[model samples]
Target: MSRQVTPRAAPFRQFIVKVHGRCNLACRYCYLYEGPDHTWRTRPAAAGPKVLDQTATRIAEHAARHTLTDLSLVLHGGEPLLAGAARLAAFAERVRERVPRGCVVHTTVQTNATLLDDRRLAMLARHGVTVGVSLDGGRAAHNTLRVDHAGRPSWPAAVRGARLLAERYPDAYAGILTVVDPASDPVETYESLLTLRPPALDLLLPHGNWTAPPPGLPGRGTSYGDWLCTVFDRWWSAGRRETRIRLFEECLALLLGLPAATESLGTEPFTAVVVETDGSIEQVDSLKSAYEGAARTGLDIFRHSFDQALNHPGVAARQTGIAALSAQCQACPLVAVCGGGHYAHRYRAGHGFTNPSVYCTDLQRFIRHVASRLRESAALTSGGATR
Candidate 1:
């Protein structure tokens, strides 16, 4: 099959660096460790200085080539904190030094929050590194799936870490990221996150594909959509917009004919790339959920430029908009808004990635719910204007 080429000129604006390839916790559903990908077994536990230097140089070259004024450098991991504070600080500094003087570099670290300490927090703060924590909800039960190696519950430590960040480093506390649990009460989950007073939050659907479909998805049901809609209604009715919910806001924005800023939805060219601990330049790490080595690009910062990775077949497929979607998706009215629901969630063994999301029904129901709410809001506004 001929590969589809994206019409728009896409450039690399985000780089997710896997500073550590080993995790302290053993989350039951982690797409990297617990999923199909076993490539992490061969990687160094932490990225060495040489890998960091080459990655920094490549990022600088990519920025200069694209004339990108702003770039987002995300410190990712099996657990980034496991790489130690000194390594992370040095890596961030090295990248910052290599970037062009005029380019703005926004650095962020996404952690499970178990290892956060006053000293580590201080170090990250000094470097202007924003921290994003992963917490399922406010209660222990909500986070039972996220446990340590011995299967001990990690909620207490995780919550403690989050509280410390919020109280001590409010400015540096970016927000929280929660993987959606359809079985959990959406309102309870949302309220629990409110306790941390996060500036923003993301509700991620469990990573799954057509072959190994996500849990709680029945053949004819839309439990995920129902769960999210309940949360949406509660958040919408609150009207204060107390905290920014990324998934809801992105969907609403797309519904309003605005450009989507997230890869979860819309046809926005995916500009994010991953640098594994072994210096492998790969597609988004999430692709590992699809199959073993699904993310590998046979490219590395040490030998290949970011521009070369951009032309990669996997990268090009994601940026190609409607051309990359399955036939059913192309004919659907919601195609522009849904954007086929994250590239990794459309995979199957025989068919490749040219398929609708495994969450198609849920997405359809959720989008329609949001659209209904939008129409109601518009009606109210029009009524007030005429009155």
Candidate 2:
């Protein structure tokens, strides 16, 4: 008998095109701006016509070659709205027009909500592009770090934008993306976000690695995990799904032996890649949090195919699944569910990305807690069936 082996490379399905290189607000903890990488400083402010055209062509070529049925076009940036809503819609149209006819393109813009106005939301909705907003949390106090160039708080404007999207353009309101802040009250943070009426939620851990540990990460404690578990309990005991909390739902799916993957977990191959503002093909942008030039692949749309990028060392490493993990990770009981953590979280100054995640203890704690809840649920169902 022969064992099945995972492929060396998987075709890219999510194309993150950086439309703008500079942000309207100067977020204090933004990994792209404040992290070790300063590559954005040298790039064009907004992706030029040449860059966008060539990128669309390259994406079409990749999709045709792979005969892909679905692909995601993520119009990203330091703040994509700085490029103007019309320009973003036009760029999305270009990709949609260029892709193979059979390929369904799902276009989205990940923006900080301060720039979202009625006109922008209407234009995005008409163009079939959804909007995903980013925030630290729901309140002004939670977003003290998210301020404008002049140091004015963006919370008031953000609130207006979020409400407008939810009220007038609900279909285009994809979700709210908030980074986990262990310092805040987890349940309070979770409930406040619900008031915005987002269809879903994207909860991301702060991007950090061993050398540059995330803020508030205790030396030997699972504070981040504890925060997540509190939120999980709140969400679970609600007796009805309030909205899609991506991290929690994905973890449950993985625990149930269902096929699921996210940037944070599971053994599924990473199939997303980034196209920088200047047309440079790179690994996931989060790698910028690890080191200077950490995301670079030396490939560009004008000269290289997405297939060519599949051969890059960083991209290949992510697709290798469990084989890419450190020996300790391979030996761990929860390897399948945690997937050795996010690739960027495994970085150390000299050792590269072979180590387990910086949040190893936190992930272990969260996974076990979820597993216990699952068992309790199963027991309840069994008892009811017996009765």
Candidate 1 residue pairs in clash (backbone atoms < 3 Å): none
> After aligning candidate 2 to the native by TM-score, how far in Å is the CA of 69 from where it should be?
0.5
* Candidate 2 segments exceeding 4 Å error: 1-7
- TM-score of each candidate structure, all chains considered together: 0.97, 0.97
lDDT of 2: 0.91
Q: Candidate 1 on 1-387: residue-level lDDT in tens?
A: 112323465988999999998989998888889889899999898888899999999999888877788999999998899988778888888888888889999999999999998999999999888899998897888998999999999998999999999999999999999988888989999998899999999999989998888996537999999999999999999893789999999999999999987878898889999999989999998898989999999988888888888889898888888988999999999998999998999999999899999999999999999999999999999999999
C-alpha lDDT score of every prediction, in listed order = 0.90, 0.91
- Candidate 2 similarity to native, TM-score: 0.97
Please, what are the lDDT tens digits per residue for candidate 2 over residues 318-383?
998999999999999999999999999999999999999999999999999999999999999999
Worst 10 residues of 2 by lDDT: 1-10
